[model samples]
Target chain A: MKARQQKRREGRDSENALIFGDSVRKCKTLGVAKRAQEEMVGFMLVILLVAIIFLIFLGLASMRSKSNVRESAEVSQFLDALMELTTDCRITSFSGSVNPYKTVEELIRDYDRDLTCENGEKARDVLTRTIQEAIETSWVFSPESLYQGYTFEVDQTTGSGASSTQERIVELTWQGNAFSCTHAIGDTKSVFSASSTIKARLILCLSRSE
Target chain B: MAFVLVFTMIFFGIVAVIYTSVSLSNLREQVAELRERQALERARQLTGVPEFAFTPISCSSCIDFDKALALKQVRTYQDFWNIKFLRLEVVYPTPIDKDKECSLSVLPPNCGYVDIIPSPSGNIKTKTAFVDLVFWDKNKGAYVKVLGRVHISAFDVER
Candidate 1:
């Protein structure tokens, strides 16, 4: 009976050791899985941060491009308007005197009287109104913007062999503002005048019926 | 620990030397490029002029022509075009008396010449040996045909 009791005690001790070993292995596995999960979370957070930074930079670049486009368009429109006015001035009849206007305001008034849009009367009215508004909003009479008190004398007049005549001359001063600047100090002026002549004439065409 | 510290120091020293070398080389390249650009700009400034250099054949022909037309020629052209105007004075060279009566084409073209004439109306289509002012009428923007066969020519000479 003593020998049988000793065998039973030995068997119980061995089983307890096996169970302890299994418990240690399970703990090690759980620790390794926790470490792997932590590293994966770290990598995901880094990727997300980089993505957000890239998006912010792209948005800023897009906004900058848009602003540049707007500025360019404004400059182009202003230049176009000035050119149109110059062309029209080349066509108007300067009757009373070569020096029609002493100030920019006078020139603008004359320009307003002469220039009409190609569209119908309503469209022409809208354009004239817009130009008038631009004149009002901007300092069209600033000394730096224009050369004041310049002389315009008749250089030459030619009569066609026919009944009418044409006149041409160089004006020392031009009234339109050629340069537009975004900054107050950086504005420039266009001092050059058109090389082409302005002609006015009255013609009576003979009708076949007459 | 001591060996570990020494190794780390050596590694960082290598990285620092490499970075400094790269930065210095990049800065030198930028400086060289800027100097080259400045030299080119100065050269262009000196070569550009109004009289002989401003022509269609010049490498910078377009820019020179635009400036001449926009600044000098336009003003003069406008003055000539004004109605109620009568006289125009253009500078002409003194007549060169060559020994031989050369054909019109054989003589070196007038080095520079000017013609002064009474201004005529641009409306009538008559051929007269006179310079006339052309203007846009309220009805027609075209200059009436007064001066016949107008041509412009220019040449570029090396500075």
Candidate 2:
């Protein structure tokens, strides 16, 4: 009886050791899989970060290019030339055999003074007609044209500092179609009078045709 | 570990290539823009040249039509400017005669345009700028100013 009891106890001890060894192997396999999953997640995160950075860079580059396209030297030069153009509107008050005609620049200065031309036309009326004709002749705004639309504005500001008052002397606008413009190239020229400042601004809007 | 290292190297190599290409393209655009600006500056400077500039008045952007008419007579200016083409047109008062070219003999009121340098036979691009065309009007007995358009083709030598 004593021998049989010792045999049974040894058998139970062997069985327990075998079970523990199998469980340890299973645990090792699970740990390796878990580590692989963590590594994969880390790699994916790094790729995401790099992709985000690249996208941001591309966005910034496009924005910079767009802004560069908006500032055109041609438009600025045109404005300068427009200001110096001598119009047929001769100011009778300053009429001489030499230079009775007032330039677009001078007309802007005299607009506020309500001066009349030698032909008895108002300075403002002559200015508006001159600007309209010049712009129409220079830039043909049609659907097929590169310039889809344009805006020419003249503003007069009187007084100084806080007492300044701004008035719109002339505003002319033309559009080719209903489509919104994608970009605008614009420039402003300021002509100072004795008592006021006259500002002339020209903006050319561009649209891409389908 | 070796697999991860290889993948990372490949990824970084692609990123570097993309970055380099983008930077190179941007640089090319900037160079093109600079070239255009230089050409425009050259055109603006041409207006202030003594041969064409209006000297009597304090006008900086004025081109004397009288001087330009005389310039048309001097054939030496063609090669002196070294430009492909140079033309000026009066835009205001509707240029009484559109076909007539202004010269020392065919003065303003009779002529509409001046061909300082005639157009070369080829597909060439031109840059245009606005200027004040001023001249002493013999009829009006005073200096007359009109809208002028200056069209200049690219220079022969890169400038």
Candidate 3:
């Protein structure tokens, strides 16, 4: 009878040990699963952060490209305006004289009167404004834009070309910087030039009377 | 352990953001620089001498203080040339004699007049006749001067 009791106690102890071992194994598996989930979440968050950064970069690149295109178009417009102004000067060959207005305002007035567009004055104004802006903007890059140089010469005719005189030459020099470059928005500039006859000729004619 | 992992992730996220902003700003600056160079090149190319492409007309006024006038046109071989005013109007068709048309005698006698005296060394002889009158040409680049011999009678104004 004592032997049989010992056997039963041993059996009970083995069963309890088995149950405790199973529970420990289950706890280990649960811990590993929780760690893996945490790692996955962190990796996904990193990818999302990277994606956001990429999007921002893309947006900035797009903005830069657009700006470049706009600048090119502006430059093209300026070239066209300059060509038109130069072409207008060719008329001097026919009239044998130039008009007196050399200022931006005078140019605009003449342009407004002569331009034949449906938009007429408005179109001329716009073109003049564009040229003015370009010239002014050039100063932003180089201050000496307008100070290039001027040459003056005068010839006098008397007694029906029997005699003539050559007058003195004048040279003017300027030393200064007038260009201003700004990276900020809302800054602007304007430029325009009008036709003017050489003042030297008039001065010479007047002097001949003396 | 969880704290260590979160901290690592946060560190990487900050680095990525900084890297991206820097990259974008650098790209923008590069683009701006390239555009500026292109503009400068364009400016240089525009420096050539522009050809005579169009004429200013009918506007009554041109740039450079020049005036547009309704005058006869004269054709020239080149676009630009100096005018050698000739008295030979008979070379072209005319409705009236140029001398009769420009009768300076209609002015009051003794009006301002200039005399031409030519010496052996000079191009003209003494008592030479000359006139002061201006003519316009639509083709010539400058006003044509009416010589004295062409209108000798007009040059004899008593003034």
DockQ of each: 0.01, 0.53, 0.02
Off by over 4 Å in 1: A67-210, B1-159
lDDT: the better of candidates 1 and 3: 3
Comparing 2 and 3 on TM-score, the stronger one: 2
Name the top DockQ candidate.
2
Worst 10 contiguous positions by lDDT, candidate 1 chain A: A201-210
Q: What are the lDDT scores of the predictions, listed in order?
A: 0.32, 0.78, 0.33
Q: Is candidate 1 or candidate 3 better by TM-score?
A: 3
TM-score of chain B of each: 0.32, 0.76, 0.29
- Classified by CAPRI criteria, candidate 2 counts as medium
lDDT of 1 by residue, A1-210 (tens): 999999999999999999999999999999988977876676556556655865685687568644211122222222222212221223224453232211122233333244333332332234334334333332233344431211122222233356445433222222332222112111111322233223211111111111
lDDT of 3 by residue, B1-159 (tens): 576567767877787788888889879866765654444333222222122111333211111111101111323412232211212111111213434322223211112222111112323211111111223334543432221111111111111
lDDT string, candidate 3, A1-210, tens digits: 999999999999999999999999999999999998887887778667767976897798678745211233233332323322321122222232363212222333344244332323343444345334333322232233322311112222223243543322221112221111111111111223232221121000010111
Model 2 chain B: weakest 10-residue lDDT segment is B150-159
| Model 2 residue B34 lDDT score | 73
Candidate 1: lDDT of B105? 29
Best by lDDT: 2
> In every candidate, what fraction of the native interface contacts is reproduced?
0.00, 0.47, 0.00
Question: Predictions ranked by lDDT, top down?
Answer: 2, 3, 1
